[model samples]
Structures are given as C-alpha cells and as structure tokens.
Target: MKKLLYFEQDSSRIRPIVVALSKHFEVSVAGDLLELAATLRQKEPRILLFGLASLPGAFSIHILDRIKQIMLNLHEEKLASRSALSVVVMHGDDSRWQQICEPYIAALREIPFCDIYVIPAATNPDELAVSIINIKRANRHLRTARMSATAEVPIIGNSTKMRHVIEQIRTYADKHHPVLIVGETGTGKELAARALHFWGKRSHHHFVALNCATIPETLFESEMFGTERGAYTDASTRMGAIEQADNGTLFLDEIGSLSLASQPRLLRVLETGEYRRLGDPHPHSAQFRLVSASCINPIDLAAKNKFRSDLVYRIADLVIEIPPLRHRAEDIPLLAAHFCSHFSKDAFSLEQNALDKLCAYHWPGNVRELRSVIARACANNSTGRIFADDIQFLYQWKFEGNSQPEVSA
Candidate 1:
C-alpha cells in the first residue's frame, strides 16, 4: 500500500476520515511543521494531504514561507521528485476556512505536482475517503505516464511562455474535450499533441495522426472515413483514421488546409461520432478524442469564410497557443545546446559568441530551423567547439526587410 502523510493542527477532528483512508494507505498524521518535514524525509510518503480547515487561525505568511522553503529544499536535494511527491490541499466550504486558507492554497498551487480539492462541508467521511482514493489513483497514473513519456517527447524550454504552454498541456491532457493548437509553422504543434496523448488516460491506446494539408481534396473522404470493398477500382476493406484512433486520439495537423467541402463532413463526425465508409451504407461509431493543430488562426480563417465557424467552435473547446521562437528568445540557448548534443556523437560545446549570435538573430522558421542549422554546423566544424563564424543563418538577407548582418571571414 502507498503511504499517505496528513498534516493538521488538530488531528483528532479528522480521525474518522483518517480511519477510513487507513484501509487503503499507510496513513501518518503530523500536527506540526517539524513532524511533517521529518515524516516526509523518513517515510517518503507518496501523498501529502494537508487539512486546511483544521489549521489554526494564527497561521501566518511566515509559516507558509517556511513550508514553501521546506518543499523547495527537498525538491533541490532530490528528496522529493515532482512525480514522487503529490501534495493535495483539502478544505471545507466554510467561508472562514476559505478566507483563512486562500493564501496558503495559492502558495501550494505554485508548487509543482500539487493539487487542490475543495470539499463541501456536507460531504460525509466515506465520500471524502472515496474522493481521495480516486485522486490517489489519478496521481499514480499521471506519474507513471510522465516518467515513461519524458524521453519520447522532450519539451525543452524554461522560458515563461514555455512554462505556461507546459502547464496548459498538463491541465488539459486528461480531459475528453477536443483541443486546438494554434501557432506558426515549425512551432512543435505535433509535439504538444503527442504530449497530451502520452500523458493522458488514453496513453495505452493508439495515437493516430493525419496531416490535413497532405491529403488530396479528392481523397479526403476516403482517407478520413475509410473504404469498403469495391468502393473504388481495386479498393479493399480498410480502416480509416477515425477507426484507427478509436478509444485513443486523432491528431489532424494543419487543419486549416482542410478543403471547405470536407469541413462539413468532418464536423458531422465531431458532432456525432458517426462516419460511413465510401461503399458501405451503414454508419460506424468511433469514440476518440480530437486534437487539431493549425499554423493559421482558425478564427481568422472562419471570418474569411474559408473555414466553418461551427467546426472551429467544436474543435477549439480548449486552445493552446504556442509562442513563436522569436517571442521566447531566452530559450534559444537551451534549444541550441540540446540540438548540438543530439546531432553530434562526440562532445560539442557552444562558445559565448556562438550563443550570442544565436540569440541575436530572429528565427523565422522557429525551432525546426534552429535544429537544421545546428546539425550543419556540428557536421562542418573540425574542432569540437562551435563559434560565431561557424554559425550561419540561411535567411540572413530576409531579416528586418532584406537588410543583412555583417559576416566575418
């Protein structure tokens, strides 16, 4: 059984709830900060449940700061990895409790891997226990999926915008609603889509991706709805992207390129999970989550009458806008170093001048273009170090309306 550590000023008040939870978890109670930190270090509980209602009225920012310090220290020391330590704040609906715990709740929310559960005052002990159990189950699944998917889909960046993007992905990954990702080309829209699939409840199911721009207008229906035997010349029974993504995720990349004629057909499937094969009369139902990406703004396309507004609303229940590389320029060095290490077998280092050059130029093609430049530089450099001279910008002349930067021989 997993260990659960609960902290409260008055533990006796929540004894019934603890007793109910004890059946599933090895429950430990802490009445003070010292005991809480000690148990966290020694027992290393999987879940930390903070009972905000039972905290004393004397709770101050000093105390909250101390708690935040403890968590930060533990995180820095690797004693509590983000995936290992799950912090849950539980409080009642009482207005007094809410007023008292509001700041503390906000503080905990800033901590990674922390979640807040607001329990109504009328909720019985058994119901609260069940809810906590379900929370534990979800945390376990998320932790497992995160650990497994980290290597496969590495989203590298520490800038504020990138952090916001990551947090949005985490917040909406487990939801069943359709998600629309809008950004410029080469902004890693497909990467964000993959992160959503790999980190969600559907991680075990297949993740099917289709590029709307690549499909021919004549073949759109057959590609999306599959084909039955004799549907066309030498056509055999085959599954479509919808059927392939059943119970999983369907990623339509560059959805803005979808033909206007094909828009209504796709919208019908989104409205009702029903699609028919080219030759088959009977309709088949597929229950899969939709994750669509487009370089052009869907709203703008709809306004111009090139795309359907209703379809846009249906696909964009949640929207994640990825900032272009130039917008998050601070992440350039990190991305450059990552690309250097990935493309070269031997150890490669970037000089200060090289990094300065990388950060100075405006990346028109975004991260993908940066990766290509890094690969070429790494391959051409005889020494293991990359310098400003070795760095080349393919579109230097196009910068700032055809004015080019000076190059050194």
Candidate 2:
C-alpha cells in the first residue's frame, strides 16, 4: 500500500480524506505545517494531499513562503531518484486561499508537483477520492508518453483535399498573422496547424499546442496565464503555456470547445497580448504568433450562443478551410504512395487497379482514414507490391456483415 500525507490546520477539514484515502493507502493526517514537514522528513509519502480550508485566518506571507520552501525541498529530496511521490494541492474557491498559496500553486503547475486540482468546498468525499484516482491515472499516461517518445496522434488524411492543406501550409509558412484552421472531427486540423508552425519562420522556437476542450475549466486561467509564488493554496511559481511559447508559436486546437465562462479571459489575452499571472498584479506580454483550429464552425456556434463571436472574429484573421478527403480524390494515390513509403520503407508499389479502387471510395474520415488503411496494409504485406487485398481490408467488415474487422496497424 502507498503512504499518503494530508496537511490541514483543521482536523475536521481532513476527516473525509483520511477516511477515504485510508481505504487504499496508509494515510497520515497532520495539523500544521511544521508537523507536516517533520513527518515528511521522517517518513516519505507516495502522495501528498493538501487541505486548503485549514489555513488559519492570520496566516502571513512569510508563513506561506516557508510552507512552499518546505514543499520544494521535500520534493527535491524525495525525487533524488525515480519515485512515485507526488504533491497535490486542493483548494476550495477563489478566496483568501488564492492570495495565500499563489506561489505553491504556481510551482505545482510547472514542476515537482504532479497536478493542482480545484474542487468545490461542498464536494463529497467519494467524489474527491474518485478525482484523485483519475489524476493519478492521467499522470501515469503522461509518464508513459514521455517514455515512449512516439505516440501517434489521431490526425490522418491523404486525398487531394489534404494536398490543398499542404499547399495552404506552404503558403502561410512565412506569414506573421494568426491563422484559423477549421475542420471536422478526426480531420487533422491540429496536424495541419503544426505543419504550418514547423515550416514557418518560428520553427526553431517552441510550438506549444493545447486542446482547449480537454482542460478543466477551473484551470484554464492558470494554465494559460501562469501563477506567482504563494498566490493560491497550492501555487508556488510556474510559467503558463503562453509564457512557455513566448518566442515561438501557440496553437490552440479545438478552440470551439472552451467553456463559455473561460472564453472572455482568452479573448482578453488575444486583444492586448498581455496577461497577468494568477495572483500577480503586473501583466506580462508573451510575444508569440497564434494558430487556432476548430472542428465546429464558430459562426454557427456564435449565432446559437454556443461560442463567443468576438473571439472568433479576432482569431479568424486568416481563415483556412481544410477540405475533407472525399472532395479531393485526385490526391488519394499520392498520399497512399507517401504512407506506403513512410510505414513500409520498402520498394512498395501499388497496382494501378488497386490504386484506382482506393480513389473511388468516398472517404468520410478524410486523409486520416486513408493513412490508417495504408499503414495497416504496409505493416501486413511482405511483398513489395500492394494489391487489392491491402486496400480492401478497411471495408472487409462491411462486406462480411460483421461488426468488427482485424486492424493491423
């Protein structure tokens, strides 16, 4: 079982956590910062859960600074070697806790800490426990990705429509204005944006891409603007994504999915090119180009009150529509040859008849689907010549009236 520590001034505030965490781990509850620091030094914990409601009314900046120092020192000492020990700062609302622990919260966001999650003060113990489990699972996935070094993303495409995308990428490779890429799900919207950034003048700098739809709404501001030391309950000091992309390019994919509540904050950042870190009074300018992509049509969403029109107008300065693969049938063979060479790296040549058949299919999934099919065929075929069977596998289930088909790639 893992060892877990909880730090909170009020024992009552941590009662639920102690009971819940004890079900799976050896949990210790601490009443004050000094006690918690001493306990941590004596017995290292796999995870640390902070209870923000226990902060005293007279908690001063000096005390908060000391707590942050303790956290940093503890983390460094524990992480001297590879270990699962991680810190989690849980705060209730945007109250005095924000001002008190801003530094700790900032630090947690960037390094040392695993995650900084915010919950409503009224959240039940069961829900909080589930949240912790989910956070751990997410961090595990992050670790895996870091280790693997090659996790294929969902973006796929191959038709002439995609060639037009490549063309647009080439065209915008030198421009400084923001480019808005619009497409449907699995349409390679992000891939196209990244291609532009990589082939652009800012290619040497960072190409920070974020999915606005997936980030928790409560973290949107902090993730984008960064936070100062001791700004909030768990904050220490960390730079936001925009700050990280200061000299490069920032790609905001799935921009349409951002919560309506958080849209205005993003708009403010775009309008002024200036933003204040969480708990910090001074605003900082992050000089970087913006590239945003959306599957949903912002115009339609705005008319329906689903998205902010003002942000749409500001970001859509250079709108580039990536056509679906069905319309660009001419590029099918070209993309197939490309994928065949890429995945097989052999002298693989597609039979003209098989190539023609691939061009006839109406690909609803666009270039992404074609790439998958090509990759599968290349991986399975031993002979250099790809035949009809290679391309036919994608539609085998449909002909056999089966719900599932074997996927090779």
Candidate 3:
C-alpha cells in the first residue's frame, strides 16, 4: 500500500479524516516541523500531504531549506524509490492557503512535485481516498518512465539493450537540445519521445505532436508555423504545433519523410527559436524542446537529397536507437507475459510449448506483433492455460537480414 505523511497545524480538525484514510494508506501525523523531521527520518512515505489551512507558526526559510535537503538526501539513498515518492499540498479552500503559501509557492513549485491541487477540507473521505489512489497510480507510471525508461513506460521489456535506452531517455529529459530517435517501424519511437517530454522539465506544459507522414505537404506551413485572423480565405487566429507546444515539447514523427520545403521551417525554429504565423508577419516567439523520430537514418536521407543535411544535423544533437525485437529476443517471454496479464480478463498462463513457439518465430513487427499474438490467444482460447497449438502466427512474414522472406507453416 502507498503511504502518506501529513502535516497540519491543528491535529483536532483533521484527526477524523486521518482515521478514515488509515484503512487505505499508512498514515502518520506531524504537528510541527520538529515532528515532521522526525517522521521523515523514520520513514519514507510515497506521498507527503501538507494538509494545513494556514502556515505553521514556526515556518521559516531555514526550516524550509532543511526539509528540501532531507527529501533530496532520501532521494539519493533510495534511487529505485525516488520516482515513487511525491510531495503534494491539499486543501478545501484556496483563499487562506493561497495567502499562506504565496511566498513559498514558487520555491515549492520549483521542486519536482508530482502535483499540487485542491481537495475537500477533510470532509469527503471516500472521494479523497479514490483520488489519492488514482494520483498514486499516475505518478507511479510517470516515475516508471523516468527511472526504468522502457520498464515503466508500458513498453514492457527488460533486456540489457533496453536498459541503455532507458538510461539515455533519463539523460536527455532535462536538456533543451533537440533529440533524434532512430528505430525501425513498430519499435516504439513515439513512446520514447513521450518519455523524454513527460519526464523532462517541459512536462508541466503542452506536448504537441506532428506526424509528417500523415500530414499533407501543402499544409506544413499552417500546421507548424501558426496563422492569424484573415491570414487565409477563412483562417482565424490560430497557433500551430510549434506555438501550441511553446514552453513544452514538439515531437515530429517520421521526420525523414519531411520534404525539403518543410525542412526550412523546422530548421528555423532550432536555429533561432523564432517563427512567424501565416499571413501575420509579426514573428511570434516559441520556445520548445524538439524531439524527432524516423524509421531511416535521417543523415543518410539527407545525403540522398530526400532531406536537408543542415536540418538533419540540427535535429539530431542526441540520437537514440531502439533495437528491433529480434535482436533482443530474450525479452519475448517477459513481453508476452505482460501482454497476457493485461489483455486477459480471466486468469491465464502460457504453456512451455506455447512459450517456445513465441520465442522461436522471428518478430519482424517487434513487440507490437507479440502483443497481438497474446491478445488473439486470450480472445479465442479458454481462460486456462494456452498451449502451443492455441498460439498462432497468422502473419507468414519473417525477417532474414534486410530482406523479408515468405515461409509456409
């Protein structure tokens, strides 16, 4: 169960709510900074709730610094648990609490808090319990994305290659430089882009995405650079993906598919962090971290005149390569088990023969193919064990080197 360390000025008013939440959370009460420090020293709760209506009489900058220091110390010592613990403040009314925390709100917000939101004044116990549970789960997912990269990102693989991928994500999550994610189709390139955005400083802002492959070449200007009222025949004032993603991240997928015409706009933003909306000559400023993905090596595309070399160099300050599933076949069983547990409504397990069959076939489509196989078995077979006969490889395609060969089962 997740734990909560709560601090309140008057213990009497919040005591009842505490008792009700004790059933769901391991709850501990702290009346003052001294007690709060004692509690922090003794235990590492997943969430810390500052449930006070007003600031404590003993509040001071020194005390505040100490609290942050202790939390940081705990984080370093428990690297695995760092992503799980969160600090949040809850209150029913904002007026008093706002006044109380206005000075320190900026400093607290500067801390990597999972969230800061409103709540009932210790009144609705049931609703708060559910909310707490939901918040805990959501934070855990984000934390998983940050710490394990692929493990918690819902990507479901634990190979040595995958661990390095996760490490790269954590490394680039904080920087402002553009990132290029290179991988084969179905290699979860977009998923890694999301991890970079959400686990980074830009997470609190918007995450705008544009898939160049799906977008028409004619609409690149309007879709990426924004437009103003009367900019076109019927265009109203609008912000494009770059403007919308200001102060956040803009992920461009299949970036190698971008024509030379659209590459200028992308290169302009990376070079100057500036762009003008269509019809409106007034250049609007947009500051965003750029993350681009492609199935092919973008530089190679540039060399072939399919992409601009200058643009390719600008977008690829850090390149992350996602290995194909066939290379990391060791993760197949774990990935298969993860999918079965997720898609199966009933209790389920895969037989040894079934597992062998899954591991034997080459997954040209990677984890995505594995998920489909498991999902199909769960839908067609009984709730019990699924044998080799029950598991089927519907697709007759497999990869051998760069060429795909057809094989009869």
Candidate 4:
C-alpha cells in the first residue's frame, strides 16, 4: 500500500476518514507541525494531506507557511524530491471558509505537486475516501506527464518525414502562436498536439482537450464557454474547456466539424482572450495556447465556404501535416514492435514473412489500424511468435498493386 502523511490538530474529527483510507493506504496522522515534520523525515511518504478545517480558527497562513517551509527543508536536505511528493489541501465547503482559503490555495498552486479538494460538510467517510484516492491518482498522472515531458520527445518514428514533424513540434512548442495539426483519419494528429503541449512552456499547466466532432451544435457554446448556475433549467455551474484550459493548452480536435455559426464566437475569444459564460452578462478573460486538429484541410473547407477563412487564418499560424502510414511504410517495423510488446504479456516476435505482409498492404486507417491489427495478431498467436498466417487483415486489398488478397478472420 502507498504511504500517506496527514496533518490535523483534531484527531477525532478525521478518525473516520483515516479509517476509510486505511484500506487503500498506510496512513499516518500528525497532530501538530512538529509531528508533521518528524513524520516526513521518518515515513518518507509520497502523499501529504493537510486538514485545514481542523486547524484552530479553521485557517491560518502561518500554518501553511510553516508546512511549505517544512517541505522546502525536506528538499534542501535531499530527503524528498519534488516529483516524489504530492500535497493535498482539504477543507470544508462552508462559503466563509472557502473564501478565506482561496488566496492561500492559490499561493499553494505554485507548488506544481499540490492540489486542493473541497469536501461537503455532510460528506460520508466513504465519499471522502474516494475523492482523496482520485486526487492521488491525478497527482500520479501529472508526475508521469512531467517526467515524460522532460525526457526525449514522446513521438515514435524514425522516418525522414517523422523527423521533420518532430523538429517542427520542438521548434514551435515554446511559441505562443496557434498551431493547426493536419492529418488523415487515425494519423495521430492528437499525438502531435500533445507533443507540442508537453514540450512547450505551458507544460506545468492543464492540457484540456475537446472534440468538436462529437459535441452537438447546440452545446458547443456551453462547452467552449462555461455556464453559470441556473443558466438554463437543471443547469449547474460548470467550467468549460476554455476556462479549464486557461494558462495551458486548449486542444480542439476535428476542428473542421465545428458549426459555422459558432465559428465567430471562438474567433472572438482567440482575438480578444475574453469570453462570457452562458446566461451571464460578465466577461471573463482566459489566456491559453490554441492547438487544433482536423482530418480535412481547413484551407479547402474555407474555399468551399464550409469554414470561415478568417478563422482558418487565425488557427493556422503554424501548421503541422502528419503523413499517413502508407507514406511512411519504413516505420512499420518499429511501430509494430512497439505495439507487439505493449499488447503481449510474455515475450513475442514477428516472423519476417509477417513483417513483409504488414509492410506490403496499404494502411488506409494509418497508425491506429496498425495498432489494432497488432493487438489482434497478438491475441491469435499461440506459440508466442506471430507468422503471416497468424496476422488477420480485416479488409481485402491489393498487395504491391497485385490482385486483392484473401481477408483473414
């Protein structure tokens, strides 16, 4: 079980929550700042939770400052690394308490590993336990993302075109201009967008993504711009993608599918960095880097009047075109090996004939289809080795411009 160090002055109030979390973590409770510092040195826990509600007067900047100092001391002593520590601040949902805690929480946000969770006053122990576990999971994911971002570029391919694509991503990652990623279906446009985001200056902030193709036209505005409480019948307060992506990257996938009527609304936000929530007369400003993807050429759509030319120019400040699988057949072997290792539990290998067959067929669905085929092949193989017969092609296609081959089941 993972270790957790929790600080709260009143033990009885948090006893039930601690018991509930025991099944998921080996939890240690600290009743004072001194005890908390002692536990940090001895426990070497990865997660630290501060129950600000249980502190005297329900909130104190001095306590938080001391906690931060303790954390800094741990790092200075080479005891806990920033990546190894995740901090969670918990408080009751009382409006007055929340208002008092807002600025302090904002200050804590500077610590990249810190998160805040608001607990309803009536929340049961089980609900609180679940929420804390989810926060821990999110912290783990963020740490992993940070590690990946700092390492080598995450895109996998050695083809000349792919290398050029990687170079483009690295070059434009730190730039504030909007980037438009163009590719065919399943050609990894989103992957390129992520690489751009993770490699950029905004990596420390959120990376919120929304698929324009999947949302209905009626909800596009509400999804892009947030909604205030009671915006409509049964509507609750919610932060939309734009607000959630503030100070970070906003990825709009299949941007060509965005309704024409909603184009100007988005264009205005891009131009002015300001937006108004649904049913709210107030305007809020957001600062985010725009990264959009489209399977279709926005230029072509603009020419046909299917898309707005001005919006196209705004989003295409920097464009990245991802080549289809067929155009980069040389990378099939590397990609195949990667997928094989990922899908198979034990060691697996592909025969030369199997490789030949995979490289010969034209991949209409690009890398996505190749991954599925590799997964299916791994499932079908019994000898831990894959042969041409073990590989299944879903669609019959001409190999090397010859007659169509047999479709495998």
Candidate 5:
C-alpha cells in the first residue's frame, strides 16, 4: 500500500475519510502542526492530506505569516532535491467552510507541491480511490525512469496508426482539457476513451459513458443531469452522470446524436461546471473531465447545423481519430491471433490463409466485427490452428438474402 500522511487534528470528526483512505493507503495521522512536521520527516510520505479544517481559530495575519514562513522554509530546505509529494486539502462543502477554505487553498498554491487537490469532505470514497490510484501510478512511473527499457503502452497493437493513437492518449492524460475521439463504429472509440481516463491524471475517479444515440431525446436531459423526486411522473431522486463523475471523466458516446435542444444545456455545464436537476431551481457544481466520441464527422455535422458548433468547440479540446481496421491491415494478424486465443481451448495459431483472408476482407464493421469473426471461427475449428475455411464467409450469401454485398473468394 502507498503511504498517506494525514494532517487532521480532530480525528473523531473526519474518521470516516481516514477509514476510507485506509482501505487503499497506510494512513499516518498527525494531530497538529508540530506533529505534521515530525510525520513528514519520519514517514517521508509523498501523498499528504492537509487538515485545513483545523486551522487556528485566532486567524491572525501573524499566524498566517508564520505558516507561510514554515512552508517557505520547507521549500528552501528541500530545494537541494526534488520531492515526490502530492497534496490534498479537504474541506466541508457548506457555504461558510467554502469561504474559510478558499484563502487557504490560495496560500497552499504558493507552495511547490507536485500537484494540489482541493477535495470536498463529502466526496465519494470510490471516486477518491481513483484519484489516489492515479497519483500512485504516476509516482511509480516517475520512480521507474531508470528501468527505461521496460516501458510499455497499456493499449494493444503495434500498427503506426494505433501508435499515433497511443501517443495522443499519453499526451492528453496530464491535461484537464476535454477530448473528442472520432472513428467509425467498432473502431474501439470507447476503449480509447478508457485508455485516456485510466492513464490520465483523473484516472482516480469514475469514467461514466453514456450513448446519446441509444437514449431518447425526451429523457436525454434527465439522463445527463439527473432528476429529483417528483420532478416528473414517478420520478425519484437520482444523481446524473455528470454529478457522479465529479473530478473524474464523463464519456459521451455517439456525441453526434446529442439533440440540438439539449446541446445548450451541455454547453452551459461544460462552460460553468454547474447544472440543475429536473424541477430544481438551484444549480449545483460538479467538476468533471469531458471526453466525447462520435462516429460521424462532427465538423461536417456542425456545418450542416446537425450538431452544436459551440458545444463542439468546448468538448473537442483534444481530438483523436482511430483509423478503420482495413486501413491497418498489418495489425490484423496480431489482433486475429489475440481473439482466436480468447476463444480456443488450447494454444492457438492462425494459418497464413486465414490471415490473408482477413487482410483481404472489407471490414465494414471494423475491429469489433473482426473479433466476432475470429471468435466464431475458433468455436467451429476443432483443430488448434485457424484456417481460411473456418473464418466467417461475410460475403457470398446474396441468394439467402443477406444484405451485405457479395464478394469473390
């Protein structure tokens, strides 16, 4: 377990947070400023939790000045080498606590921590675990720089196009900008979205994916922003995907299907980080990273007024396009063998004929279609090796009334 240095004086009140975090990290609690400094020296914990709620009641400029001096002194003392420290300042969510903590947040910003998180006292534990794990992964990556030869891509495939996709995922992981993935259906758009979320800074929170096309426009707003009890006939209190994905990622799939009527609503939340539940007059704040995917050309759709141009601009901060499987035929053999192994009972191999057929096939359904074909082929093949005949004859059924075009073998 990773070490966590928690600096909270009133452990009785925030015991739940400590308990929750203990499930993930080895929590070392410090009761006061002096104990905090002692724990920092003894534990050398990279991940620190600041108990800003326990700040001095006196609230003197002198007290603030003394705190700043201590922080600055630590900076100078640790300046000789880089520290692997990450900090989180937790505060209550109510009005008065927000007012009190805002200045302290600004004050801590002046100190040089690798990253600073201003977390709410009421944050969901599962989501908090995501944040903790993200930081832990990053820290491990940083420490393993010496083992450079062992570096690897979390996503599969060695094709040039896939490599480009991987590179884009890596580049955008650290940034808070919204990402838009464009590709044909079955081209692993959601998989790529997962790569972005799990490998990024916000990897510690929930990655919520909603398919706009699958959901009706009548319920789109309610689905995206949630609904309150009695808001509609038989409506019960519920949190929307956006609110649930707070400080995490919200992946909107088939983004082209987002209705124009609901587009402005999405735009408002993305711009202001605030949304109102159905029948609720007051707006609630939710800060989440937006990652959207579309099979159609959003730019072209915007030109035709099918998609909201402003919403497109807000969500497409970084865009990645995955090429169709046909365009990356070199990866087909590797992908085919992978799927074949997934279905086969014994050690698996793909015959050259099967690979040739796969490469020659018109992949209308892209990667997903290919996987299904390989899976079906393996189930039919008693022999450990997959041959061309075992593969799905996707074409040649015209007289039987298959809609797809017939092609010569």
Candidate 6:
C-alpha cells in the first residue's frame, strides 16, 4: 500500500482524512513538527500533511529564517530524491499565522518539492484527495521526456487518406488542446474521440460522454448542471457530468443539437471554470478537458446562425476531420475484416470476392453502414469463411455518379 505521513495539530480533523485516505494507503500520524521530520527521515512517506501551527514555536522573523534555512539545507540533501513528497498546510484560527507563514511559504515554494497545497480548515477529504492526485499526476508527467502511455490507432488501412488521418491522430494524441472531430453521420467520430482521450494526460480520470442530440431540450440544464435539493419540482442534490469528469475528459457528441439558450451557459463554464447548479445560489467549479464531435459541418451551421460561433471556437481548439468511407475506399477491406471478426463467434476470414464487392459499394451511411453489412453477412454465413457470394449483392446498391467503377466478383 502507498504510504502517507500526516502532521496536524487538530486531531479531530485528521481522523476523517486519515480514514478516507487509509482505504487506499497506509497512513501514519505525527502530532508535532519534530516527530514529523524524524518520521520523514525514517519512513520517507509519499505525502506529508502539516497544520500552519506545526511550523515550530515563536512567530518571529528569526523563526521564519530558521525554517527557511532548514528547507534550503534539505534541498542539498541527496536523500530527498527517492519519494514523491507533497505538503499540505492547513491554516489555523490565528490570523497572525498567515502573516508569518507567507514569506516562509514563498521560500519553501522555491525549493524542489512535488507540490504544496493550502486548504481551508473545513475542506472536505474528497476534495483534498482530488487536488493531491491531480498534482501528483502533473508532477509525474512533467518529469517524463515522452508520453508515458503508448497511444495507438487500432484501425488499419494502406489508403493515402487513411494514412493521413492516422498521422494527424498521432500528432494530436499527446497534446493538451481541446479536440473537435468532424465527419459525416456514422463515421466513427466517437472512436476518434476515445483514441485522443486515452492517449492524453487525462486518461486516468473518467471519460464521461453526453450526447446533446439524445438529451431532451427541457432537461439539458439539469443534465449538464446538477440541481440542488428543493430547487425545482423534483430536484435533488447531485453532481453533474462536468464535475464527475473533473480533471478528466468530457466527450460531448453531436454538440450542434444543443439549444442556443444552453450555449451561453456552457460558454460561461468554459470561460470562468465556474457554474451554478440549477436552483443553487453558490457556484461550483472543476478543471475538466473538453472533447466534442459533430456529424454536421459546424462552420456552415455557424454561418446559418443555427449554432453558436463562440461555443464552436471553444470546442474546436484542435480540429480533426475524418473522411467518409466512400472517400477512403482502400480502408473498406480493412474495416470489413475487423467487423467480420468482431461479429463472428470463431475465427473468420473474408473471401477476396467479398472485399472487392465492399470496395465497389457506395457507402451512403459511411462506416456505420459497412459495420452493419459485415455483421449481417457474418451472422448469415454458416461457414467460418466468408465468400464472395455472401457480400456480392452490395455492388448492386445505388452509388453516386462520382463513385469509382465497380470491381467484378
């Protein structure tokens, strides 16, 4: 188990935090600064917690100077390198404590430590845990030279268009910018979004997805901003998807369908990192990365005033456009084989005739249509191997005049 060494003058407050963190870590308690420092040297704990009062007696410049000297001297010690150390300072009731701690805190900040958090005496343990974890993760990421996670695009195809898309995905996977995926309906927009999220820094947090088109217009506010108890006809206190996805990625799909009235509310949250729950006077906020996708051309919709231009700008920080299946014809065989294997109970191989038929067909419904066709063909075939006759009828489907000539079975 992970180790935590906590030093707090208030034994009452420490009990709750210790209980909560102990579920995931091995926790130890220290009542005073001297004991805490000795425990630190011996145990080398992962995290350290201290109350503002724990900074040794006598609140004078001399005392502050002594603390600074000790911290500076410790920075020179090679023994401090092994563990990820974080210090949390819980301010006491004395107003004078802040004045004396400010300069010392600034000096401590310059020293190389994982992180330093200042929280109210009344702060909840869950919020404390969230802040600690985020800082821990941020520190780990900064220390690494390359991405700690190897993000790979699972789809395979040799087509020029497919190759370009994969390259673009690789380029944007590790970036911090918001990503907007654009494509025709059923073009695997969600797949692209998940690939980016899993490859990015926020992968450890929840990947909460909300479909704007799927939600009703009346409930959009409640769904996005949780309601407070006694706020509305049937309101109950709850956390919204935004808070649930705090420090993680929130995937908003078909965002164009969101009402214009709801757009400004979303814009406010993105701008200020704050939002008032429905019927709640106080505003709560969280740090969440946004990833949105739309099937329609967002630019065209914004021009027509059907979609908010401001919202579009916020969500489209880094846009990725996915080509329709008809445009990336070479990918048809690859996608077909993937889906056939997905639908078959046992290992199944696609005949060359079926692949030729798939390439010849005009994919009106894009990737979704291909998946459906492959599923139907796999379920109907009694044999494990798929034959040309199984998928030959796809060539007879009506194609746009610009479509490539049909390849014969």
| Model 6: residues with Cα > 4 Å off, grouped in runs | 1-153, 229-236, 392-409
- The weakest ten consecutive residues by lDDT in model 6 span 141-150
* RMSD in Å for all candidates: 15.4, 10.4, 12.3, 7.6, 7.8, 8.5
Candidate 1 stretches greater than 4 Å from native: 1-152, 397-409
What are the per-residue Cα lDDT tens digits for candidate 5 across 37-92? 77776777768876555444234223334545656666777841365466766554
lDDT per residue for candidate 4 within 1-409, as digits (tens), equals 9899888876676788788879798999998999999998998988887777655434566777787778768767877654556566666544465456556655555554444343333246665565566556655655676666654555789999999999999999999899999999999998899888888767776677899999898998799986765689977556678866765789999999998998999999999877887976656556789999999999999999999999999999999999999999999999999999999998689899999999998998899999999998998787889999877766653365566666544
lDDT of 1 by residue, 376-405 (tens): 899989799999989987775344555765
- Number of the top lDDT candidate: 4
* TM values, all candidates: 0.62, 0.58, 0.62, 0.67, 0.66, 0.66
Name the weakest run of 10 consecutive residues (lDDT summed) in model 5: 145-154
Worst 10 residues of 1 by lDDT: 114-123
What local distance difference test score does each model get?
0.78, 0.70, 0.72, 0.79, 0.73, 0.70
Question: If both were scored by TM-score, which would come out higher, candidate 3 or candidate 5?
Answer: 5
Q: Superposing every Cα of model 6 onto the true structure, what RMSD results?
A: 8.5
Per-prediction count of colliding residue pairs? 0, 28, 0, 0, 2, 0
Report residue 21 deviation for candidate 1 (angstroms): 50
- Tens-place lDDT digits, model 6, residues 39-68: 767777777666544343244345445545
Model 2: residue 90 alpha-carbon error in angstroms: 31
